[model samples]
Target: MLMSAAHAQVSLQDRRPVLKGIETVDDPRRIPRKPAAKKSKITVLRGGRVFDAVSAAARSATVVIEDNHIRAILPASSTDWPTEARVIDVTGETVMPGLIDMHVHLTYPDSDANIDEQGSAVDGAMRGTRNLRWLIESGFTSVRDLNGVGEAPYVLAQWSADNAIPAPRVFTAGHIITGTGGHATERPLTPTHGHDYAIEVNGADAWRGAVRQVFKDGASVIKIASHFAPDEVEAAVDEAHRLGLKVTCDCEGIYTEMAVKAGIDMIEHPLPRTDATITLMAKNHTASVPTLQVYQNVIDRNGGFYGSTSRRFAMTSQDDFDVFKKMKAAGIAMGVGTDTIGDANKMIPNVYIAELKWFVKGGYSLADTLKAATIVNARLLDMDDKIGSLEAGKLADILVVRGNPDQSLDDLQKVDLVIKDGIFYVENGQLVTPRHVAQPLLKPSPPETTK
Candidate 1:
């Protein structure tokens, strides 16, 4: 479920129901590993001013891609070009690491609706497949879905690999863990619904058990929602770390202090936080995903709770904005995310660009903002070693834009090409790979019957 950081609440003495049948096993099949395909093509993307995320500035260079990894980054004047490799000249463009969005929801496509509950599995799958395509075409090569409904994350990963879906590399936290009656609670609060979208536990022991279940269910990361007790948060973080998974929490309110104290690895929208809390987060080396775009979008399009509160926040003071600035100044690692849920037209790729603009408007340098979207986000996902930058030995996830984004952030919207895992997925702002279509098992009968 989507939540705004503005509605964060907590009850220190909240009691949890003692339920039975909380069972899980360390299933070996949890984390799927795709067998490496037969060696891929060796294609060298050349003659572009490369912006390796680690570099101080963009430089004229030639990137040599072999198989699925970057072989080397050579000076633009190098003469030793391999004859067997296919070289594509990307002159006059900025070649940088493919973008990464830190927070997203693949299961919920429409913000105005809950597709997970309203539609069939096939319906959700089709929407997710299409959304993935839209993101990749818009220059995002990878994203982390913060929450998903039941086995959807694993299923999506399998489809991308087993069926060769042309989509961004996806990482997911299978389900959000929240306290009983917390932000993500289902209305009826039934057991089936509890397991479907969230793990609503009570005590520290229950939190640990839920975290174990999440790992056993194939989540690469664990997410905890707002309103959790300090011990519960600590136990969740401890169990996740012990199990080799990172933990991120929804710090929509005062939970920021609790999350930081619990040694949480990342905080989603660690806003409405005091400078002391921001400083504390930096001291603890906790990363953050400030999904400011969601608030702005809500304010612009709807006057719902998120919209009204966001408006008030915007009008009241630059408090949150100043907090974000303090976060960056305090050396808190910030990653970019557009928590946009809705139709693809205005929500997707465009929302990501809007977030970038907000970062610049928030006083972040263009280079720092781009880094937050790329390498910084990659690091937040523990994928920096493979996919973050345009460096040798890294996976070749590249984006070529028409103009230098360093000079003007708007140039990012003009993506000329997108390359993921050494494959050219988009060229000249057009999709090039074969589309992945979800074939439903059951076809709709008549319109009336289907309804």
Candidate 2:
């Protein structure tokens, strides 16, 4: 009888002879492959002074991260970390929630006076990509882009998710909605060019239609430019609210009162207003994003950025500052925003530090200043649950700095490490990973010598 092919493939003398009911296996490649080992998802950050943001004091703690959320915040003296966890010793560092910028124009990257005119949509996208990476390494893990040109903001949002670009989590308002010829058009050289930053529509119906269009265009927030009719303002706010989107308005003078009365959720760069208007804004629970850094820049340039209006500039004009102080007294929420336009080189993270110092000068304590940048801003974005505080169960968007920001506002700029979604992006003041495009190191310029 002829032997089976399996028995014929093997040496008959080398193996036991195959019986009629037995089978022989000689193929080496047919051996079973063992399963690959699973990578560990647990990480432990030990020996850090954690700033919980809710309290005025820092405490020694160990933050245990499981996947993307913080699993536990144990006492620093505890030694209960899982043996499989990767531990990062942040001894002597100040660990706090990552910073949040309430307002920005990610697509606008020019320090020149004609920033709005210098870039096309494609150019803005490229520059925006670079800026986003810089923001993340600088400790800003999330941003609210109030006005972004074309599809740049939406594209950046997707890129950030795909890790095509290392950008902060973005909540974008695609374009500013304005009256036919308002603040959005005042600077752009031509009416057609104005569409780069804003869309012009007239009448209440037009305002409602514009709000719907922007929502369709993927805007999470609705930003109405200054100088719209009262009915238009009311219509925009009502429509945006109905659509479950909050309304933020760039308001000045009488329009500020109108916007507040119309139930607008936030006001940007609020113009100096009457006491009645300020009180009304506080009463209405409307928040403010004071882009004091840009205002101070205008003042520093001798008002050159605003032409004749530059001379009139002050860091929150005395009267306006007084009103804001009063509003603060009334429990109105205020957050910091740079609003720096032009280049990534010009609008570096230091601008944010400068803004914090101005807040300090304006009588905000270090704790309140930090709160404004983190918890308060997070609340403004309606993300207080998921971020803003170094609490258990929150996404691990955190910063480890060299010193206590509560001691010196300047320490906020000392970003020794940045972590987003439980992933380390910056360590030892350097970017260890670049998601898509590699970012070049940007060093600060030396102080100018006096003549």
Candidate 3:
């Protein structure tokens, strides 16, 4: 039961395998980069239970992560493993890919229950740095941050890329584009709100300019509130795509329909989609991210406009469960995104467990539910080449739990080990980097006096 220490897929092409090619993808385990004979930083996670993220099945395997990358996965028992490298023996544990939450607010601060986006760029950067540490420690190795103040997300993205900071892999949406008074826009009554945060553009021409601004700022993904017109959605999609970026729209009513029609890449918050709408989405290759639990949080709060808690919760009650089943049956690309960003679910990893229940109620058999979170969502982020599955040569983003997650979804809450990019983040349920920052992480500042 010795898995080969060599596994590297030649990407930069379709699934065309080229085992013997000159231009190969970087393989840390490949034949010595040169004659220097570089040493490997290997970590053999000895005995553990692993969720076959690719196949969505649990398998007893010995996975070795070397030099911050996965080297191999062997189908063998963990009896007597090597002692040289960093090793973790989770004899009675389960493992899967670190979770991906497509919707999160790393820079959005809150007081009471309302999120505030009026922070300075530096403030956002500091908050994002702190949030990234919490995210990775909590088992989220990757995240699609919606929007943040200024270029704060981009700075954080660069930090994690260098591993100068250990945090979740970030796919940033930069800033949001919105119509005159869309959700992202500030209300006149709310003085604390930052009206300048969203790129508020009304006409198609204005949207084009905004898209150019976001592109200039290096946005990995484009996000716009489609509460405007179909023409507006179409214009945003055309411009954003022209710049080689995917567009995600946040909406519920006609906005969703417009977004799907205008060839939007994805939609957040799965509302009750119609049969015609579902068909259009399937045909147009559009995806829906049902941030159901987030919607539930809004319902729990029962704020103004949606006033009644029980009624608002019942708003998408029928639409919630069936939308996923119908989409799955219709062969539409339905990805997973946890929109719940406050209270207990504020910690990203906890949302993955609740998200399963949303799909479960939608007639998704347990296996498919897990797949949607791991592989399905990974593919949407255009990061399938590196992450998503427990295959060799991929970045070793793994999670080992106490019980089979499929049989009992709650088993994930009791994770024994979490490995991301060959780094063992959690060992036996205790994080290598603890989440809580009880004491101040900020350095000392000198006092200032005015004459």
- lDDT by candidate, in order shown: 0.73, 0.74, 0.68
Return the TM-score for each candidate structure: 0.82, 0.82, 0.80
RMSD of 3: 10.0
Off by over 4 Å in 1: 1-40, 114-121, 161-163, 186-195, 302-304, 307-317, 343-346, 434-451
Top-down TM-score ranking: 2, 1, 3
User: Tens-digit lDDT track for model 2 on 1-451?
Assistant: 2222243111112112222223221111111334335454998889889988888878999988877678888998897868989888888889999998878888774654454454567877887787887898898888888776678877876666455566677778878888876766664343223678788898888998999998887777789877787778878887777776777887677888888877788888746667888788788788988776666666566643342211123343454456557767777889887775643335668888887877787788898899889999887776676788988877788889989887887887788988887778788988877446656659866679975
Off by over 4 Å in 2: 1-40, 113-117, 187-193, 304-320, 343-345, 434-451
lDDT at position 415, candidate 2: 88
What lDDT score goes with residue 389 in model 3? Answer: 79
Per-residue CA lDDT of model 1 for 12-71, tens digit only, reads: 211112211222111212233344566756787788899898977899999888876788
lDDT score of residue 442 within candidate 1: 97
The residue pairs in collision within model 2 are: 109-342, 109-343, 110-342, 110-343, 111-342, 111-343, 303-310
